[model samples]
Target: MAVDMKTIEHLCSLSKLSYDEEGMEKVMGEMGSIIDLMDEIKSFDLAYDDTKDGNEIRFADTREDVPEESFPTEKLLANAENTDGCYVVPKVVE
Candidate 1:
């Protein structure tokens, strides 16, 4: 893949990223290498029927929801620096 400096500079400007000549050259080289690697991968023989068993095909492990014991409001409120029969938080607005 041939990377143009003008295109790279344009992309950098669009992304609001500052890159000097050296940095631009480095980035262009890396991007070109990545594109070449993708091109190589595209040459591979990929068939759906050739697929085998799934590896680490995981599912969410969940449990039935049940009623749980909770602390008394007074006990929880006692730990607060300031409370009005509920949780206390810093005033957000004047």
Candidate 2:
């Protein structure tokens, strides 16, 4: 697909952007290059084995969730700068 001035103008209008002739030309060139790259990528013959089992398509090894002991509330609150039985943080909103 060719990136033309009309298309650039339309895109700029939609984005509420104002570009000079030189900037428009630069953007058009970049867009054209991107489109050409996409076309090249689209023409590639990517083949994958479809006979593989669904269970064998694991990207990472899964681990079982094991319950562990946790620290007491008093122990956790001991590290807080200011706590009224809970953590104290700065007021975020008015």
Compute the lDDT for candidate 2: 0.86
- The per-prediction tally of clashing pairs is 0, 0
Candidate 1 Cα misplacement greater than 4 A, ranges: 40-94
> For candidate 2, lDDT tens digit of each residue in 1-94?
7899998899899999978989988999998888888898777787766776465746567665788878999899998889998889978897
lDDT of 1: 0.81
What's the TM-score of each model vs. the native? 0.39, 0.40
Candidate 1: Cα lDDT at 79: 82
Best by lDDT: 2
**Per-residue alpha-carbon lDDT of candidate 1 for residues 1-94, written as tens digits (9 for 90 to 100):** 8778887888889999978888889999987888778888777787565356565445565555788889888997898998998887998996
Q: Let me know the TM-score candidate 1 reaches against the reference structure.
A: 0.39
Per TM-score, the best of the predicted structures is: 2
Off by over 4 Å in 2: 41-94
